[model samples]
Target: MLRFASLGSGSKGNATLIESGVNDKDTRILLDCGFSTKEVEGRLEKLGRTAESLTAIVITHEHSDHVSGAGRLSRKYNIPVWLTVGTSHACRDNDFYETHFINSHADFEIEALNLHPFPVPHDAREPCQFVFSDGASRLGVVTDLGYYTPHIISHLDKLDSLLLECNYDERMLLNGTYPHSLKKRVHGDKGHLDNKHASELLKKLDLNQLKNIVGMHVSEKNNTEEYASNALCEGLGCEQNAVSLASQAEGFSWREM
Candidate 1:
């Protein structure tokens, strides 16, 4: 069996726990460690797990909200960290227990889980998203990206599950109180994915085997769960309940494939 869960997701912090295999030999991997070590431990406990149970921590980039506790967690638990060369340079200060440099276009394995990292356009040091598989089931996680590109669409073709970003609503973003510069940055091509853009991208993907669709990294100041769900539902031609939202406080529970 293959299953995944999110500890939390937002601009403040983000972490995902993915497990592959069953019984005593399951392999667990944390996709990102954006929160403090103590906070992460608490969240892991919520899922009935501990930091020591993780086999590896895979970082998408060097952004503070994505890598803040990765080094500390790995060091404390003696877990290896996998990231790109650029991300390594950007996080030179963090002391990792073991570091494995991964290529953006390469496929790597962590026990029963297979990971494929693909580059994305984000304002960070070589940021990328991932597609994971446990031989039979595929799960794609695409977040913290600016605009959707053809390459991204191609990479996310068919999957058993998808966690896609629906960062903001254009109307709320334009009418909100954020400074002009910050607003521009948030809506820029190298910023985050707005609801409409995310919806359009979903419409172009192949979702024949899709069992779940999650809207993630929503902007608290500029987006609403209703809007995000409605947008993605429109694209998928499904009900609002079909697409779940990952929140800042209580991340969604585990879903299996």
Candidate 2:
């Protein structure tokens, strides 16, 4: 079976563990490493994983929130780290990882997981989210994008599980305590996704095969789990309980697909 779990996900940090294996041999790939090595290990332990379980570390971008611990963890564990060329250059200067530059638009297979990385619009060096499959089921991770594009929607079509971003509530961020400049940046084209945009994206997608849609990367200051879950469910015409929420503190438990 194929499954995934987030170590933690938010502005503070983010990391996802996607594992595929049968019987005994398993291939585990970490999607990002925003926390320190110790913290990542601790979270992994909670999820019944360890550093030795990883086959590789695949990065989404050079942003600290997504890559803070990637270099250190990969180097210490002697794990291959995959990223876009731009992201490698951006992180190479820091001297953290042994890098493998993968084409953002290409499809590749690593053991049981078929990985497809597509470009995303965000204020980072070559940011791209992923869609992973193991023949029977597909899981999409589409966070940190400012807005949904036709390419992204098309790529995620017929996914079994999705870790989609719902970063903020428009009204909450606009009228919250943050400064005007900060708010503008958060709402900019290269910034985070809001609830309305997320809802619209969900409405436009084909979710017939989607079993678990986790609302991820929610802002502590501007977004709440209830609000995001309700909005997504409303858009999908499903019950609110049908959608799950991943918070900054613990994220969510391992979900099977």
Candidate 3:
């Protein structure tokens, strides 16, 4: 079986755990480790797992909220970390862990799980999203991207599960308390995706095999669970309960594909 879980998802911090295989051969990977070592360990414990049990760590970018504790976790548990060359250079302080530079257009494998990383239009040095497969089921995770592109749509096609970013509601973001520059940054081409854009992207994807649509990286102040859920539901033409939101604290529990 192929399954995944998130430690948390937001500007505060982010981490996701993907697992595949059965019994003794099971392979577990931490997609991103943004929390402190103890915090990540505790979150993993909630899913009946531990950092020591992880097979590897794959970093999406050098943004603090996405890579804060990746180095510590990898060093503490002696787990290998995969990241792009630019991200590796951008994160000079996190040089303690054993690192493997990955190509954004290439595909790689870690035991039973196959990962394909693709570039995304984000402000970070070299941001990317991933798609994972255990030979049968595919899980696509696309967050922190500023906008959707045809390449992204092509890669996310036929996903069994998806964790897409729904960072904010347009009106709320423009009218919220954030400073002018911050607002522009969050709404710019290199900024995060708003609810409408996320919904539009979903409508463009092939959902024939999609079993779950998870809204992730939602803004705590600019977005609400209701709005994100409603937008996704409208785009998918599915019931509200069919969509799930990945929270800033509890995130959602594991779901199998």
- For TM-score, the strongest prediction is 3
Residue-level lDDT for 29 in candidate 3: 89
What total of clashing residue pairs does each candidate reach?
Answer: 0, 0, 0
In the predicted model 3, the residue pairs found to clash are none
Residue 187 miss distance in model 1 (angstroms): 0.7
User: Which regions of candidate 3 are displaced past 4 Å?
Assistant: none
Query: Model 1, 116-231: lDDT tens per residue?
Result: 99999988888889999989989999879889889999999999999999999999999999999989988998899999999999899999999988999998999999999999
lDDT of 3 by residue, 1-257 (tens): 99899999999999998999877568998988889999998999998888888999999999988899988888889999999999988985566468888899999998999999999999989888999999999999987989999999999999999999999999999999999999999999999999999999989999998998799999999999999999899889899999999998988899999
What C-alpha lDDT values do all the predictions have?
Answer: 0.91, 0.88, 0.91
- Model 2 sits at a Cα RMSD from the real structure of 1.3
Cα deviation of 203 in candidate 2 (Å)?
A: 0.9
lDDT of model 1 at position 155: 92
Judged by lDDT against the true structure, how good is candidate 3?
0.91
Candidate 2 wrong stretches, greater than 4 Å: 92-97
